[model samples]
Target: MESMTETEQRATRDQRARFEALARVVTEPLHRYLLRRAEPDQVDDVLSETLLVLWRRIEDVPGLEASGYVSGPAPDPDAVLPWCYGVARGCLANARRADRRRRSLLERLTWTVAGAARETGDADHTALHAALAQLRALDREVVLLWAYEELTPSRIAEVTGLSANAVSIRLHRAKKKLAAQLERKTGPHPGHETDEGQGTATGNGNGRSSR
Candidate 1:
């Protein structure tokens, strides 16, 4: 490969210096945000991607962006960097995009699993599962993405092949339906027994009938 010209070398050094400084301020927060979006186990992968972006586009990284400071003897550059939130947010969006394509087929699978059944005595689990069984397909999928799979809306869209806005809307509606289900579960109707907001009883782990 051709050696970098002196001009390119100087430019690279300056850019590296700026990015070092940016990393000092953002290291902790960036890692924490990634941990939340992905997991502690995946933090390194996400962080690597974030830093790679910073390195590749150091020139594009304005003093106010994610460029690092010159390290060691290089005096702390008295320059304002881009809001760390912006950097982390962009990184998160990129990470989410990367997850989308891989999850496409799996996300297309049927929402309901044959194994999910009502639990006895655990009123909370029973109530929640009952509500899930009552939700519309799209809405239920969004709720499971967040609650069960621990995914953000962007990730959910990648799986569901829906837009982020649409995923958010469906999630909201799903949660509301879940809440309404719980409400009706306690609501008085003939043949339906109210637990009086106490603990409702079920039998065989699947029956809606009171014990």
Candidate 2:
């Protein structure tokens, strides 16, 4: 291979520094995001794919356009994370699609083998998980993004490719649905109310109060 010129070497260094900064800020949150949506076995693989896409498309990450130099300030996590989450979401979907194909084949070949039941580790959240399962996939995703990721509607719009208004509407409806489901499971307490005015709800696990 030909030796890199001084300029090419500097460019390579800058790109590495930028990606390292981006990865440090996103890796944990991205892991949680994928863990919530993907199978335990697939989270690491899908997260690797997501980080690979982020490396390949580093220039497209928001707030990094001006950071071409290694010494420049790191990109803001708030500004960059939503876009990174979007990439992870896409990668997880691709993994799930491939998994479905493999699972279909396995099911055909092992029709006599009993499937294992899914277990939620926390007994407290069993009702919450069951309620989440009852939602339409898109609605459940909207709720997870709002509750677990703690994304604002606009940020969620960035991640999910829905318009901000649509995100707001979906989040509102999903919260009401979730509150109703949880109420039915454990009866309502006086203070346990959905924040309809602010578009928020509470649940036992992985859920956050919205501002």
Model 2 lDDT per residue over 1-211, tens place:
5556977887777788889988888999999998888878889999999999999998899877645545667678899999999999899889877665444423321222121111211223456567778999988887666654568899999988999999998877766666566557665455545656755566654566644
Q: Which residue pairs clash within candidate 2?
A: none
TM per prediction: 0.39, 0.48
lDDT of 1 by residue, 71-131 (tens): 3443223442344455556776766665553243123221321112212122234455566
How much lDDT does each candidate structure score?
0.59, 0.72
lDDT value, residue 151 of candidate 1 = 90
> Candidate 2: lDDT over CA atoms?
0.72
Q: In the order shown, what is each candidate's alpha-carbon RMSD?
A: 12.9, 19.8
